[model samples]
Target: MDLGIAGKRAVVIGGSQALGLAVCERLAQEGVNLVVFARDAARLEEARAHIRRIREVRVDVVAGDITSEADVDRLAQVTSETGGAQILVLNTPRPPSPMRDFLDETDNERWRQAYENQLHGALLVLRKVTPLLIGPGWGRVVAITSASIKQPMPRHAVSTIFRAGVQAALKHLSMELAAHGVTVNSVAPATVITPTFRPPFHNVEERVRAVPLKRGGRPEELSALVAFLASDLAGFITGENIQLDGGQTRALY
Candidate 1:
């Protein structure tokens, strides 16, 4: 698959490890110059080294918390100095504790924090990157959201709420940005095997029972879809929340 995005510049938020890293790896393979952002300086450096070893594309690492306004400003500054990012991948992690019941977890602070992490961060990134996308006349923005937005997950109240907000925001942004040739879309995955989050399921059998595919998804599988969405082939696709959940949400409809 010739993604038709070689030489394009990209910024992958939370790209130090797990699904973020997988997306970076796939994009790098397609010859996209990448700017990977994450809080862990060591992990970001390590990711850059690993990607360089495997691909010929240039990879720059930005160590900063996506939730910080200063960090996001710095990312825009650094990217502009080189060349603004044409593809922006918002792949930040959800807050740690999976409090099942929304009523039990009535901590307003927790909800605020989760919103800042998942939704605000992407909004900040997109706001700063909009000029770049407009300048290029073509861009791809894909948010790595969760399938919970489509059908709420059992013990993921924060993700269910916050990711829904993200989807809503992206839906509006897609329409607004379409005139500039920038497509805004999201990819929602079910149970991708990532180290960031621990699934409540006790075993593979339990997880497969929920998915019609009968198994959890691999990082590569999710990454491939993300890469496709970021490609020129996906130009006509916008305002969509494509689920790569292996039929897990089939029962919802």
Candidate 2:
């Protein structure tokens, strides 16, 4: 099916590897022009090359952390280069430390940094890039979050808390932007075999014990949903926390 997004420009944050890279590749496959954002110059280039090989789409690389105001500001301008971006995929590959117990979270600075790295950072990008979409009256914002946003993970204190905050913001943004033809939503993905989850999933036996599917969710699985969400097919869906868990979560709502 044609997603009705051919030639549209998109910016995928932290899109150098794992789900981010996968999303970029899917967008390219759909004939969408992409600009991958990352803090590591090398990783961004690697993603750029990989996407170029996957399809003949214009893939630009932007190097910067999402947590920085200056970086987001720069990205906003970068979007203008491709006639203003129509899609934004906010992805953070490296989540903060897993502080299971309240006592483990000893420093206030740690909390501040955690929120800044994930929540505040993405919010800045949203602020800077909204104008590009509003002017054209069409846009897609898909946040790559974790399953903890719906079902709290034992050790993920900071990520769970802030991702829920982002989900709430996306809900509000959906309502605020609905009239303008912009959609705001999130994808709370399940377990994936990647460097990002190695630490959390160190105890492999313990981790998959609850997964009814008896397997881990792949990065591509999450990216496929993201690509759909960014496309016209998902036009009616917004303000939702769509889970990509492998039946790890049992909540029906």
Candidate 3:
């Protein structure tokens, strides 16, 4: 599949590892120049080096927290220096756990922290990158959200509430950006195996029991959908939240 994004510049937040890195790898294979951002400098560098070995695309790593406005501004600046970005893949600071009841067991401060990490971080990134997308008159912004937004996970109050807020923002932004040839959409996945965070599902059998498809998802499975969404083929798709949860949401609803 020719994603039709070769030579295009992209910014992947939290791209140092896990699902973010997997998306970068898929985009890099399509010849997209990447600016990968994360707070850990060593890990970011390692990811950059590793991607370089596998693909012949330009890759740069910026060390910073997505939750920080200063860092997001830096990312926008660096990406602008390369002529602005055409694809924005947002996969930022995830919740601590997918099955913890922060609302009942934790303090207000902890709940606030989770909200800041998920909602604020995404808003900051969008604010900083909107101009880049608007400038070109064509853009693809894909937010990597969680399936919990549709089907709430057990005891994951913080994520359930905050991630839904993110989705709402994206929904409106997609409409506002539609006329400009930019599409804003979200991909919500369930139990994707990633190094940065782990879901409570211990084994395949247990995980599959909840999903009608009877299995958890892999990083590559999620990335493939992201790749499609970021391409010209997905031009007419916007303001939509597609679930890649292997029928989990369907079964529940």
Candidate 3 accuracy as lDDT = 0.84
Model 1 per-residue lDDT tens digits across residues 1-253: 7999999989999899999999999999899999999999998989999998879798988899888999999998999898778999989576646565777778888888888898888788878865677755799999998888888877688778877878888998899999899999899988787775464532455766788888789999999999999999999999988898888885443
The per-prediction CA RMSD against the true structure, in angstroms, equals 1.9, 1.6, 2.0
User: What is candidate 2's TM-score against the reference?
Assistant: 0.94
Model 3 TM-score on a 0 to 1 scale: 0.93
Collision count for each candidate, in order? 0, 0, 0
Summarize candidate 3's per-residue lDDT along 1-253 as a digit string, tens digits. 7778999988999888889999999999889999999999999999998888879799988898878899889989988887778999998577755346644745777677888889999999988886688866789999999888887877778777889989988988888888899999889988676664433524445666777776678899999999999998899999888898888785443
Which parts of model 1 are misplaced by more than 4 Å?
A: 199-205, 251-253
The model with the greatest lDDT is: 1
What tens-digit string does per-residue lDDT give for candidate 2 at 40-141? 999888889889999989988889888989988998887787577889888854456655555577778878988998789878877887667785677898
Query: Clashing residue pairs in candidate 2, if any?
Result: none
- For the record, the alpha-carbon RMSD of candidate 1 to the native fold, in angstroms, is 1.9
TM values, all candidates: 0.94, 0.94, 0.93
lDDT (CA) for every model shown?
A: 0.85, 0.82, 0.84
